[model samples]
Structures are given as structure tokens and as C-alpha cells.
Target: MIKIVSFVMLIVVMLQGFTLESDYNRAHQKAMQSDKIFIIFLTEKECVACNKELMKIMNAKNVSSLIEKNAIFVVVYKEQKNTFPIEMLYTTQYPTLFFLDKNELFSCKALRGNIQPKELMNCLKLR
Candidate 1:
């Protein structure tokens, strides 16, 4: 009985993690409707650094909570370039992070390359 209860609790906790939308248009729409910022994460499937950075972001509790409360998070892979914006094409780095304000404009400088959880929190506070 305890094991079953623990499993259920685990599932619930896992479900509380940040949700990454794949479609930029849909995510932007939702963000505008909610009056929240839009956060775009550009990554590549075969990039080890990107995967590691993503894992750090997801595992950071504070970062997850801040993102959930104030932003619409979206992940666009290299294979899904069609979903990305032309403005973002200038970036060739993996695991790039962009924060768009409520007006759908960039809130701050784009973060490229490897980023730690604390660095991510600092970036969020910038906007």
C-alpha cells in the first residue's frame, strides 16, 4: 500500500514539471492571452550540451516555478526549424535561450551556449 501511494505521488510531482510546447505560434498565442512572457529554447537532438542544460533547467525547482508562473516555455529543435522565427536564424548555437516580453519583443540579450540553473534564474529576473 505504501509503495502504491508513493508511486501515485511521484506521478503527480512529475506532472508538475514545466511543459515545453513545440509549436511557437500556439505558445505565443497562449502567452499573449495570459499576459505572460514567452521563453524560447533552441536546441539540437544530438547535442550533449543542450541535453544536459535542459536537464539542469528542468531539475531546478525555483527556475521551474518562476517559468510556470511568468512565462510560456517552448522548445524548438533543429529539425523543427520551420516553427522558428527568421529573427532567430542568425543564431547557430545550441541551447540558446530567448525571452520575449509581454509585447512579444525580446526582453533582454539572448543567452547562447551552456547555461547553469542559477544563470537561468538571473536571466529570468532581468525581465
Candidate 2:
């Protein structure tokens, strides 16, 4: 029982590690240190369909081999606008993917709205 409990907890933490960061500064710092592109995913709190589509992409097979390794990611909701930098606080849609490098912070706006998993994977390759 003890071994089983420990295994389950380990699995939970490992899964959580793959999820996008909720803090912009931390993700940006990570990007700088790891030489990874920084991507900010913006969504409104009530956007269900958009969130599902994003989940499909993030939870796709070979996830750890792709986006997780290539980018330092953060997700920002409309309600959390005050938490991010003023320049990063704006978005044109309910869901948007903003890709930025350390040299050019918050400058690149990628996708808007629900995106397919294949599309996101393709975009990842170009970055």
C-alpha cells in the first residue's frame, strides 16, 4: 500500500511538470536560462472549447519530445491580466499564442482561437 501510494504521488507530480507555467517571469527566466522560446497562451476563464482544443495539443502523444522541450511556456487568463507585464496584458482574442524570444519580448503573436494539435506541432518546428 505504501509503495502504491508513493508511485501514484510521483506520477501526479510528473504529470504536473509538463503543464504550462502560470507565472510569466518564471517562464521567461527559464527561457533565458535554457535558450528556449517563450510562449504565452492566453484564454478567458469561461472559454471551454478553446481550452479543450489547447488540451488536445498539449496532451498529445510524444508531448515531452516536442513542445515541452522546445519552449518555456506560460498560460495567462483574462482574469490574471494584472499579473503579467503591461505589454503582455493584451490579447486580440479569447485565445492566443504569443511567441517571443529573450531578445524580443512580447513581440510575436502567433495563433488565435482554437488550434488543432497537428497545426501546433507544425508551428513548434518553425520556432
Candidate 3:
């Protein structure tokens, strides 16, 4: 009985974690409707660092909470068909974090490379 209960609890907890939208247009529209910033995470398929950084964000309670409260988080893979404006966010690197305001403008400087949890929270708070 205890094992069954624990498994159920674990499933619930995992389901409560932050979710990233893969559709740029839907995410952007939701962000505008919610009056929150849009956070775009650019990653590649074979990037170990990007996966590590994504794990950090997912594991960090503070970062995840802040993002959930104030931003629309979207993950766009390099090889995927996405609607992200390449001119605005041209990057030669993986794991880039771009924050855009409710008006669909750049909120602050883009963050590149691996970012710690606290650093992600700080960056999100800046906008």
C-alpha cells in the first residue's frame, strides 16, 4: 500500500514541474494574453551543455517558480521548424536564453552558455 501511494505521489510531483511550450506562436500569444514576458530557450539535439542547463532550470525551484509566475517559457530546437525571428536572435551557440517583454521586444541582454539556477532567477528578475 505504501509503495503504491509513494508511486502516485511521485507521479503527481513530477507532473507539477515546469513545462515548456514548443510552439512559438502559441507561446507568444499566450504571453501577450497573460501580460507576461516570453522566454525562449534555444538548444540543439547533440548539445550536452544545453541539456545540463535545462536540467538546472527544471531542478531549481526558485527559477522555475519565477518563470511560471511571470513568463511564458518555450524551448526551440535548432533543427525544428520554429517561428522565432532569426534576425533578432541570431546565435552560433546552443542553450541561449532570450527574454522578450509583453510587447514582443527584447527585455534585456541574451544569456548564452550554461547558466546556474540562481543566475537564471536573477536574469528573469531583471525583466
Candidate 4:
């Protein structure tokens, strides 16, 4: 019984918290239709702190509320073989966030490295 409980708890923990689609095409399509912006989050496998910080900011109520309403959050790993188009996502940073217009054609300067929740919220409000 204890083992079963532990397994169930593990499953619940694994499924908890935030996640995003890594597919840019799908995100772009949705963005075009919904008048949403694209938050192309370029992450790296070994950047543990960066990943944690992103999760924290994304999970924060203010940041998430603004983002969830205005953007199609697409997560792409920098070190992996990317499935998304690289034209707009081109960047060298390990954990960079590229915010694009609804057309997914133009992007402001990429937000690189650790970013605060308020900073992200302010950016989201611009779109």
C-alpha cells in the first residue's frame, strides 16, 4: 500500500506545474488566428538555473495571467535539433526569449539570460 501511494504521488508530481508546445508552426497558426503574440523561449539542456527561473516566472500569477491571455508560449531548446523555423528564433543565448508580433514576422531584441517576472509582464503588455 505504501509503495502504491508513493508511485501515485510520483506520477502526480511529474504531471504538475507548467509546460508549453515546442512547435512553432502550430503556435504561429494559433497566434495568427487568435491575435496572439509568439513567445519563442529558447532554452538549453544544461542551463538548470535558467530553466528553473523560467518556470518560476511563468508560474507566477501576474506574469502567467498576462502571458496566457496575450501570447502563444512556444518553448524551444537551443541545444537540441529544432523543429521550428530558425529565421526569427536565431540567437546564441542559452536561455533567450524572443517575443514576436502576431504575424510572427518581426521581433524585438531578444531578452537574454535571467529575467524577472515583472520585467516579462511589462513586455507582454506591450503587445
- Candidate 2's residue-wise lDDT over 1-127, tens digit each? 5346335534543574554677777888888898887777777765766666556555576643576778776777768644565664556676777778875464444677776656666666766
Model 4 per-residue lDDT tens digits across residues 72-113? 777666655646656634676667778888766655556777
Each candidate's TM vs. the true structure?
Answer: 0.80, 0.72, 0.81, 0.74
Predicted candidate 1 versus true structure: per-residue lDDT over 8-101, tens digit per residue: 4345435766667768888998998988888898877667688667666777789988888888888777677465567787778988998887
- Which rank order by lDDT, best down to worst? 1, 3, 4, 2
lDDT of 4: 0.67
Model 1, residue pairs in steric clash: none
Clash list (residue pairs), candidate 3: none
Among these predicted structures, which one has the highest TM-score?
3
lDDT of each: 0.76, 0.66, 0.75, 0.67
Name model 3 segments beyond 4 Å from true: 1-16
Candidate 4 collision pairs: none
Each model's backbone clash number: 0, 0, 0, 0
lDDT score for residue 9 of model 4: 34
lDDT of 3 by residue, 1-127 (tens): 5346335534543565655776888989999899889988888776767867776676677787888888888877877776677744568887988888876788867788877676677768886
**Residue 42 displacement in candidate 3 (angstroms):** 0.2
